[model samples]
Target: MSEPPVSYKRHRFPPQIIAHAVWLYFRFPLSLRLVEKLLLERGIVVSYETVRVWAHKFGPDYVRCLRRKKPSRQDIWHLDEVVVTINSEKRYLWRAVDQDGYVLDEIVQIRRDTRAAKRLLERLLCKQGCPPKRMITDKLGSYGAARRKIMPKVEHCQHKGLNNRAENSHVPIRKRERAMQGFRSWSGLQRFVETFPAVRNHVVPPHSHRSAFATHLHRLAAMAEWKSVTLTAA
Candidate 1:
């Protein structure tokens, strides 16, 4: 069955404006106030808090409409975790990315152990609908333990040098964390990661060596798709 269209019935602004605001916030590391200022410069007259509300409200709906990475038996999964400081407490943000530099799934947890690794792998399997051809990670024993139990047949490579794809994936989120001055809570961090990575992966092509013209065409297509998925009412 086809999903229902997202309703934008009662808002004062048009769906385009709301979608654009959400896009500016997630598609870049821009702050809420920065988004507000940008809109105001165009005579939109919205507050930062309103942009925040729109992002939290409509971001998930947009994510649901975006195309996800397809499951492939040939895909190589790169799994890694990073420390996030929330309210003076340290939490681990576990993420899995495919070889093409697309984020597959992410989770926030308090522990960095075999159990945590298992949880991430379980979620990945559920989302991707199959185990990958191979899994790569740093010299983390937890990943080895979890892989042995969860995907015993899949090849597992544990080497710091071989896992640069996963490690480099953390850079964007780290920049966003610093730009926002740090996340306040685990739930907030989770929500941010959930929307941010999807938007980034959608607009930013994975190939690093594409020509300027090719990159331009890719972004043009990405913008068109974004407008279609967000139901831009202009």
Candidate 2:
């Protein structure tokens, strides 16, 4: 049986309006107020708070509906963790991405230890449904320890120079973090990271590009897919 379309029965605005609002908020580094301003420019009167509510309620639904790349045994996984300061407290955001620069998984935790590394590894294994050909990371002992316990057969390369791809993946999050003026709570940061990466992975051009025409086509397809997933097709 086919899955039912997304329900927007109680929303005051149309699905397209709400989905567009949500997309504007996530697809760019725009704040709620900025998104509201952009919508007002379109002659749509909506408050920033309304945009916030729409993004919170509908962002995950869009992520779930969006298509994801299938896991393959030949893939190379790059794993890394970065510290995020939330509400005067420190936390670690662990992320995994494939060789193609597609974000595979992310998790926020209180520690950056072996246990935390193991949890991230476990999540990736469950989500990807297969181990990659090789794992690369900075000289983080926790990752090495976790790899041995989780998948001893997987090739592990520990070198900062070779882990630039994983390290560079943190740049977008940093930009969003600065724009938001830092996150207020751990849960909120977790939720934002989850939704943000999915939208970015879908819309942005691939890490390695071929031509301007190809890039344009890539974005066009991304926008179409976004509309289809968000149930905002015209």
For residue 190, give model 1's deviation from the true position in Å.
Answer: 0.6
| TM-score, candidate number 1 | 0.97
Which runs of model 1 end up more than 4 angstroms from their true locations? none
| lDDT agreement of model 1 with the native | 0.91
Query: Could you give candidate 1's per-residue lDDT for residues 55-156 as a string of tens digits?
Result: 988998888887766789999999999999877899899999999999998999999999999999999999899899999999989999999999999999
Model 1 residue 198 CA deviation (Å) reads 0.7
Error of 1 at 78 (Å): 0.5
lDDT of 2 at 43: 94
Off by over 4 Å in 2: 1-3
Shift in Å, residue 178, candidate 1: 1.3
Worst ten in a row by lDDT for model 1: 1-10
